[model samples]
Target chain A: MKCGYSYDELTAYFDGELPREEQSKLRQHLGCCGECASALEELRFVRSAVLSAWQAEIQAPEDLRSNVLGRLREEGAFRESLPVKTPVATGKGWKGFKGWGAAAAASALLVAGASWAWLAGNVDNAPLNTALIENKPAITEHIPPDKEVKEVTEKEPDGTAGGSATDNQPGDKPGIKNQGTAVTSPEKPGTPRQTDNAPQQTATGAIALKDYTGKAFLSVDKKSYSGYFQLTDNWRNYDSLDQKIKLTAAGYNAALAGSFKDSGGVVTINVPTASYNALYEDLKGLLSAGGIVKGSDTTVESIESQYKVVQTELEKVREEYEASAGDMEKQNQLANRQNSLIDQMEDLEQRARISTIAIKL
Target chain B: MGDLKTDVLIERCRQGSEAAFSELIQIYQNRVYTICFQLTGNSEDAKDLAQETFIRLYGALPGFRGQSAFTTWLYRIIHNLWANELRKRKNKQTISLNAPIHTEEGEIDRTPADEKSNPEQLIEAGEERKLIWTAIDTLNQEQRTVLVLRELHGYSYEEIARGLGWSPGTVKSRLNRARLHLKEQLLKLGVKPDKESQKDADIRKKVKQL
Candidate 1:
């Protein structure tokens, strides 16, 4: 304290922060009092001296930048997804239900809607359809190869021949009730056999004839797409939803590509890129409004092309490494370039095969 | 640094664009490092704090809704992290002095370099400037923080209060106390202002001429 004023008052005066009247009084006191005057000057000198040394910019270490970027890249796929809360148009109906309950309800609706659509179709009597469903590539042992499809079709009226014969075959899984198999039946005019490999107009139109794990596809058979879908289902439904997702993927022959890692909400599955649009349409029917946080699509070709570009660069670097064998530094740089390219290629390869549909149930 | 560019970069970062985030680091790294250095008074810890700041920014990009300026949000992270570090240091202070310092590289010896005791480093700067830095280094965390923000960064009392989550009255008092503490430290360091204060030198010259 000085001149009957607290240090706060003097500091405020030094900063021009004292009220106009009090500032004038302090200024008057300072003229007669050397102590108050020097205190104010000392404040000014301290500020100037600190500013002089530190005003120059200080560069952060270069490795700090790399370490941050490297850590982010390392966490690339497993990073927590952004909380995207965009309302989905279809999810609006289940607005009352929360979390997994909403998802189960929506999926239940999908099962019923699919069953109704199948029962309404006249293709029920088609023998070739029976071959695709009852005698799936896995269950070929049950169907007699000599029986003509037309003859099998004609026996549908009797109900005794085809139904009774297949009933005793262990191939008839309990859920394979005609409704489950027929729900995924092709809706287009194409013959049922053609639905096995070709992309169809509807998500339910193409059915997986071969078990998902049976054959290694030689070509890029899937596109890459991701979605943030919310199901107002709660934690209690996690097990049931987990089982249903597996069954649903099996029903459609889509591979359950993702794990139930995060609170049982995120379910990732791989459908043939040909069936990508169809599966996307199928999910839109299951989620509620505000359920779809985001959806994005990218082509398998694009991912492959990116992989190819990285491969080409890797090859170029390899050639450089081979040519500069005597130079250790250049070789070290080439090795690092190769390692990063390999990492990128591996990531793209996995992405090309999996069309990630992140159903946040 | 323009609002439009920052917004674009922020949006890209939210969308998981590493390139844009790297660019943001480039733009603010120096400023962030400077603040960290000023607070910690050591290059190694400053680097660690700056790296931690960017990594936290990356994780938190999704939550940033542009409610405040990017720098303001960035400073808040630094402030919070520093507070945590201070708490951790306070806990460690209870340990024996001979306990090894656990750093990222490994455990280092506890024999910290005495910056003031070295005459060669002190002589590298003008005496007043050196004294100011030494005084700042000796001040408590709150005083140093308030002094650096209010004086060096030109932040208003209200801005400091809002950023630090203190009341305006608290900011006023803290800044006042910080200045006086700093003044006392400078005087203790034997900082004579005749050479430092241009006004005092000018007055002395006129008095001599008269």
Candidate 2:
């Protein structure tokens, strides 16, 4: 009776979903109401348009058929290579049997061998109990050099090593007494001297460094300390140290490895010892200013500085060594841990460097 | 099995006969390509989709049970592949709205030689066709597929339902809705409806209702 019909009824009218009685009623309504009539007309036009559009001419490219055939051939070849069920005729009837038993056996053997090797490798790398026992003393003695320095510098005159006021002590000038105590008292003269000559431990503990500075694979350039600080600061503010170190090591090795020729002659080498020290001083300044109060902040700055120095020196050695080493020998030594570390550092530095964007005024 | 020629070709193709496969492709290529083009609204996408359809069909041929017509099965495969491709490209932010006018060698010749048939009228009709196609592209994939199969390919409702794995009622309803949507679009394009068109529409509505 109403002009506006339910969607279901409209759909039925459109789709012939109505019964004969309803269809006649709908038609009677369409014949009378201009709006419903117009709606039905519009619906017809839309349907015809869709139908014509659906019938529009189309053709595949000339090469498409050939390409499809070629792909099919490739798939066929691959299928042929796989073990296939073949029909074999016997006195009874045709029976289906799979062939390539030998090939399957060979494949299984190879998989088994690879799995065994992987398991053996994992077992060999299992943390050695002996090494852990051996490392106990060294680990205890290895007071994180930074923490030791901080503990010594922050000590109070009462011999307590935490937060305490020097103003409480009679006859003590705040700045002078604090500085004197920080620089001299806690470290006995002999203790400082002994620490300076403490044996340089090799990274793997099997080798010893007669001269830690000289034997160091990585050394930051002291002269470039200011530049290194700026670079690292730029890196920290805009980029990540891990990413920079990774990228730098990657670029360095890629250049040194001759896989990439440096057009700008900027190999993006790591921060040298001097630069690292400068960064260290910057960190210390930050610490002194209370900017490095957070544990993460202090640890990140110190580690970043140390890693920069080590990475720079290592790259230099690698570049020099690469020049003298035979190509085959270098290839063979590609899996060496030392080389891997150098590569990792270069990669980090490269990533860090790229992340630094300059804004032009 | 009664159609020996087709049966032999199918058997040969199943047995890895390249020539047989090529022959089959040639025979069915246009229909399949047209179906793909209608579904995808682009020639390049249609070609790739058609090729993939054939590849899948060929791979699955060995397992095809003769429960349905071979062409029916092929249509089902093409439809499924096109559906997947549509889903894949759904996330792409950019889409060209203009329907491609066939300019290549085998384009449908719209030129009417009879002078009485006005060239202006033919041109108007062509433009109308283009608008209609553009509107068709707006339909959802299933609605579009059902409409195309019914109108362009002239597949029976049962065949379409079987191919698309929808109930007969679903096919009928979807086709009706799709047509109605298209009709509304055509009215927007300023096509005037007449009594004759209304009567034809009435008959179609009646057929669907049955």
Give me the runs in candidate 1 sitting further than 4 Å from their true place: A77-361, B1-4, B63-68, B87-128, B167-177, B194-210
Instruction: Give one digit per residue, the lDDT tens place, for model 2 in B60-179.
Output: 554354555677667777865555444433433353334343432223332222322443353374565554554565666667778876755556677776555578888888887777
**Predicted candidate 1 versus true structure: per-residue lDDT over A124-222, tens digit per residue:** 322234333332111111111123443543443211111221112111211112211232221122212211111222323222321122232211112
Error of 2 at B120 (Å): 10
Candidate 2 residue A121 C-alpha distance from true site, Å:
42
Model 2 / residue A70 / CA error / Å: 0.4
lDDT of 2 by residue, A1-361 (tens): 2667664565557556588899889878777887676666555555554554433345556665665655443222111111212311111100110111122222211100000000011223221121122211110011113432334324322222111121112221111111211111111222211112222222221211111122221222211111111122111111122222211322343313331131122222232212222222222222222221111000001123334565677676667567756676764454353554554454333222221111000
lDDT for residue B120 in candidate 1, whole number 0-100: 44
Candidate 1 chain A: worst-modelled 10 consecutive residues by lDDT = A111-120
For candidate 1, lDDT tens digit of each residue in B81-169?
A: 66545543432234344545432223434432343464344444354455556566655666667777676666677777755556789
